[model samples]
Target: MDELSVKCLLHANDQVILVPSACGLQEMVNKMNDFVKKKSVKVYVGKTKVMVFERGESTTECDLIIENEKVEQVKEFIYLCSRLQIIANMAEISKKRMNADNKVNGA
Candidate 1:
């Protein structure tokens, strides 16, 4: 989805959470409750690091940098990047969980 849609969704959903990518959300999963999950999205423009993270399944963090871009444009980019990360992370976790479940069942 686009940035505005993503932001709207985040504001609307109580289950979604956001955290800054610099906060090391990946290393803090154990402290999270069972209802929460980890999500991360990274943006690289020829090696620059621009990343966003959603942690604890209830927050949405927006970190949009405006260098050559306008304020509104940067805001959208930030929202989109963060939302993408959340989706990607969720998919990854789901896949891993499925694989683990399969292994246990097949074993």
Candidate 2:
């Protein structure tokens, strides 16, 4: 997936942004900042963080730094109401789902 879409969904008083990183993290952030500037919206930097999804790669070199603080990387994230992993693995997701179901059923 190219993931080259500008997502801007407004809900009540909050908005969501889903920027694709076809280039790199820094480039994506720059692109997002440029986009925000064009739209004349202020980005709440304190509330913003980066979630990197990659497999079999060292992320030590990836510095998703905004301002002076480095954005934290998360393994799993909840978007909307569903739990989504950054890396796409159908089997893993299915297994995790089954485990959750079993735990619930067992209880």
Candidate 3:
């Protein structure tokens, strides 16, 4: 059996974990809960959120728990200044010209 590794990103005091499957994702969450308790650190559960990026047709369902509490799942979340939108909520905006050329062309 091959040992699967959890892919994680650490930036300052923030941590981001990405797993291939829902099961793996849940396992990682559980591990994190244990780690925080052992280190005697506080986890801002209310500020924590979980998001699964997948195709529009595919529904990726996973329950993420922190400190025995379920974390909020959001379709679109703003990270830094950019907004992370899901496929279902993705849209395109087009801007039309407000005014046409004032001067008429001399033929």
TM-score top scorer:
3
The 10-residue segment of model 1 with minimum total lDDT is: 68-77
User: For residue 64, what is the lDDT in candidate 2?
Assistant: 70
Candidate with the larger lDDT of 1 and 2: 2
- Give Cα distance to truth, residue 56, candidate 3, Å: 1.3
For candidate 1, the TM-score is: 0.23
lDDT of 2 by residue, 42-68 (tens): 666666645555664425344576655
Candidate 2 error regions (>4 Å): 1-23, 56-61, 86-95, 104-107
CA-lDDT, candidates in order: 0.38, 0.61, 0.67
State model 1's lDDT.
0.38
Query: What lDDT is obtained when candidate 2 is compared to the true structure?
Result: 0.61
lDDT of 3 by residue, 54-92 (tens): 766336666787767888887767666566666553342
Output the number of the lDDT-best candidate. Answer: 3
RMSD of each: 16.3, 4.8, 7.4
Look at candidate 2 and give me any clashing residue pairs: none
Residue 61 Cα positional deviation in candidate 3, in Å, after optimal superposition: 3.1
Alpha carbon lDDT at 20, candidate 2: 52
Clashes of each: 8, 0, 0
